[model samples]
Target: MSNGKVYLIPNVIADGTQEQVIPAHVLSALSGIKHFLAEDVRTARRYFSSLKLFPSIEALQFEILNKDTDPNTLHSLLAPVFEGNDIGIISEAGCPGIADPGSLAVKFAHDHGIRVMPLVGPSSLLLALMGSGLNGQRFAFHGYLPIDKHEFSKVVRELEKESRKLNQTQIFIETPYRTDATLAALVQVLQGGTLLSVSSDLTSANEFILTSTVAKWKSQPRKLGKVPAVFSLLST
Candidate 1:
């Protein structure tokens, strides 16, 4: 039997409109796919409905691939594709395979010799880094920091040191509800001259992306509130 292809579908960063963040070709590709592996089934359904590209949501098959999903179940998820049915992988937000569980499915497709295609869309991390004025050529993406205050501080300092030593950019994100707390911790821990970038509510009307030194930020700090955001750092 002929194997099918796997498409990596990116999701919107914010809740405004789909057309603003998703590319036209991605929507066109989505219109033809009937199977999907998503980080959140409900969110995937909502995204599909927003596009109006698919024939019917009820007719599509969706498999959940969140943090709680077991690695053992990945084969079963790709069974349809092996049977000649093209499948799509969608995340809760942004592109899959970056701080998302959808990477597991992509890896499986690669191991099985299945073709995988990635579509263009909004990515808060990349957007933040692009506006950071930092070393985009050599950057690292550390999804989320340690939740413990002490551990988080240690990690923050280490990333700062590495950034300063190698002139490499360090990027990470925090849960929406804890954005303020994370920002406070970062501002207090990183060196005064360290450059920081914050991108929030990307692709939405209320979007904001700012880059400034830690000292300047302390003089006039802005609350991140509960909006989803991406943070990057570069030492000077």
Candidate 2:
């Protein structure tokens, strides 16, 4: 029997109108997918309802797949798909499998010979990089930095050095609560001429994306209370 395809769906990054961020094609895919592996089921329910993609939220099946999810259970998540049932994998925000636990399910699908389809949607990191005017040709996403101050500082310096030496854009994100501290660390740890880009509340009405040198950032620091943000670095 042929296996069903797995759709790696994308979600909106911030609290905003759905039509503004989610593509029509993504919604169409969601309309036909009744089973999902999501980072947060509650959020996924809310997202689907907000987008009006499905007829009945209560009828859909959802499985939680987060950082704490056991890798051993990933294969079982695809059992339905192997039974000729198409399934959707959703992230808490942005593209599934990028920085989310959805990667586990996607990997399992690949190993088991199931087809995988990625739908178009807003990715805060890529959106931030595009707006930041950073090196788009060559770049890397470091996910999250170490929370320990010393280690974080050391890694920040290394990323700066790589950006300087390779002309590669360095991208990373922090928890909303740690946004300000992360921003401060970037300015303090990077060289004066290193370019830093901070994009916050991307795709929302309050979206902000700025790129400046470490020296200028230090001179005119901006407050980024508690909000979703992406940070990028490029050394000139």
Candidate 3:
């Protein structure tokens, strides 16, 4: 019933902004995809409900692919599609496999000779970069830094040194809720004048960008809300 393989769709919801937005285009693009691998079925359904457009998702077919999903379950779920159908894998928000789930599906798809196509959509990584004013010619998405303060500090120091030597832009994120603590740590531990760029609520009405030295960031009492965000640092 299919040409076996999984496709990663970003569906970068809501103007592709990180502010709890879901763009209409994401669904429109995948209207033909009867089968989808959702990170969370309940949440995904609710999102669809908001559009007042209901697709008989359960009738179509599905493979539950969450961070908590087991590897064995994934294999069996994907096995039936001996001729793999084009699966639309979605994250809770933004692109899948970019700080999101679907890594297992992608890996398995690759091993089984199933084609994997990633559809273009909203990505916080690029969104922050575009406004950061940092040299985009070269950059790196280092992802979330370690939670341990000591390890995180060490990692930042190393990244700072690495970027200086390589002339590369380094990016990272903290759990939305723990933003204050993480920002505090960076403001305190990072070298006094380290240039850092932070973008919050990217693509939303409340969107904001702050580019300044660590010292200046510390001086400013502003705090990032629970909105999606990205932080970037580059060598001067």
Candidate 4:
């Protein structure tokens, strides 16, 4: 029997924005997939239901695949594929396997000779970079920054220095509640001339994207509230 293919499905970055952000083709691609791996089954179900793609979500099978999932048992999670059943991987938000744990499954598929197909979708990092007016050709995404005030400042400075040396954009994300704090730290630690970009609630009605110098940011501070945000910096 032929092995089943693994489909990497993308989820909406924000609630109620699927119609705006997700492509029509993605829904069509998901029609044949009955088995799924998701970080949060409930959220995944709700998201799929919002699409109104399936008449009954109960007919689908969902397996939990999160950061806490055991690596040794990955085979079991993917056993359905070995049985010739195609499985879809859905992230809590954004594209699967970018910063999500879905990457592990993709790696396993590659190692075991299973076909892996990634569907087009919204990626906050890429969107932020594209809007930041920064060097998209040379950029790196550091998933999350240090939380400690001192450590955060130190790292921000180092990232700024590296950005200046390489002319590369440095991107990172922060907890929604910590968005303002992270912005403050960036403004305080980076040089006055360093360009900083903060993109919040991307693809949503309240979407916000701004790229400005550290000095300008400090001069006109804005509250980002507790919303998902992506931050990028470029030192000229």
Candidate 5:
């Protein structure tokens, strides 16, 4: 219910052979409606620049908003179309509002009467689950966990418990710098016989999808360093 015809754009992943593709048609359809509130202005700007598409700066369109912006000003910046303008929210990558700043904007717009339009594209988490061959029908996408070691441990324990009780797949991610540590913690803490699916650098040249018990996962080489990734676990 976010106000004023909101459009959601996705960022596609590139395999070694295939090229990276952005939903340019999504942009084309958004012609003249140039109010884009992006998560990372730099990344968004890079995206358009890579495509050689110059956006209408007159409409106050560009990608480069701060993540720590004031709630009121943020809402005002992303307010749904009042007269005749439409707002577009794009994540640094993938679907907006899933795990990006756009969620706040979307909620604010909805509270006021702004319409939200969600577009489909590559989602690393979704893709990981799809190919995980786990309980796809019942899964939870727990966005990045707290970086605090103790807090992260508690979160993992709770997720493990929920996964066990609901027979659901718990999917979560950590910052790239903490990937190895996260895996090590899981290996040390998770109960025996727990099934884990760790995917690293997915859809890229160094892509790796591995499924094993927590004990076995510890033996594999570390995941990609300091980059985005998805980690999934399933219970018996």
Candidate 6:
């Protein structure tokens, strides 16, 4: 029997913005998938229900696939695919496998000779880079910065130095609650002329995106209010 394909599905970055951010083709592809691996089953159910794609979400089978999931158990979690049943992977937010634990499953599929198909969807990293007016051709995404103030400060300076030397954009994210602290650290550690871009609550009604120098950001500070945000920096 032929092995079923593994579909990498993307979830909305913000709540209630599926229609605005998700394309019709992605929904069309999702309609055919019944088995899923999600970081949070409850969130996945609620998201799918909001799309009104399935009459009964209960009819679908969902398996846990979060950061805590053991790699040794991946083979069993993906058993349905081996049985010729296509399985979709859904992350808590954004595209699956991009800074998400879903990458583990993708890697397993590749190693085991299973077909993997990635559907088009919203990716906060790419969106932030596109809007940052920075060097998209030469950019690096560091998933998350250190939460420790001292370590965060050190990393910020190092990244700024690297950005200046390579002329590359440095992109990273922070926990919603730490947004203000992260912004303050960046402003304080980076050079006055360094360009910093912050994209918060992307694709939402309250979406806010700004690109300015560290000096300008310090002069006119704005509160990000504990929302998901992506930060990008470029040093000249």
Q: Model 2: runs farther than 4 Å from truth? A: none
CA lDDT, every prediction? Answer: 0.89, 0.89, 0.75, 0.94, 0.71, 0.94
Residue 40 lDDT, candidate 2, scale 0-100: 85
TM-score winner between 2 and 5, please give it: 2
- In angstroms, the error of model 4 at 206 is 0.7
- lDDT score at residue 101, model 6, on the 0-100 scale: 97
Better of 1 and 3 by lDDT: 1
How well is each residue in 1-236 modelled by candidate 2, as lDDT tens digits? Answer: 77789999888888765788787788778888889998889999998888866778999999988999898988787778978899999998999988888888888888888899999888888899899999999999999999998999999989888888899999999999999999998888899988899999998888899999889999999997999989999997
* Residue runs of model 5 more than 4 Å from their true location after superposition: 1-4, 12-21, 55-60, 63-66, 219-223
Query: Candidate 6, residue 97: CA error in Å?
Result: 0.6
> What residue pairs are clashing in model 1?
none
Residue 87, model 1: Cα distance from true site in angstroms: 0.4
| Total backbone collisions for each predicted model | 0, 0, 9, 0, 9, 0
User: Candidate 3 on 1-36: residue-level lDDT in tens?
Assistant: 556557677754344242244445655656766577
| TM-score (C-alpha) between model 5 and the true structure | 0.84
Q: For every model shown, what is its TM-score relative to the native structure?
A: 0.97, 0.97, 0.85, 0.98, 0.84, 0.98
What would the per-residue lDDT of candidate 1 be over residues 57-157, giving only the tens digit for each residue?
A: 89999998888988899889888898998999998999998888888888888888999999998888888888778898999999899999999999999
- The global Cα lDDT (0 to 1) of model 5 is 0.71
lDDT of 6 at 105: 98
Q: Which residue pairs in candidate 2 collide?
A: none
Q: Which of the two candidates, 1 or 4, achieves a greater lDDT against the reference?
A: 4
**How should the candidates be ordered by TM-score, best one leading?**
4, 6, 1, 2, 3, 5
lDDT of 5 at 226: 63
Poorly placed runs, candidate 3 (over 4 Å): 13-29, 52-58
On lDDT, the stronger of 4 and 5 is: 4
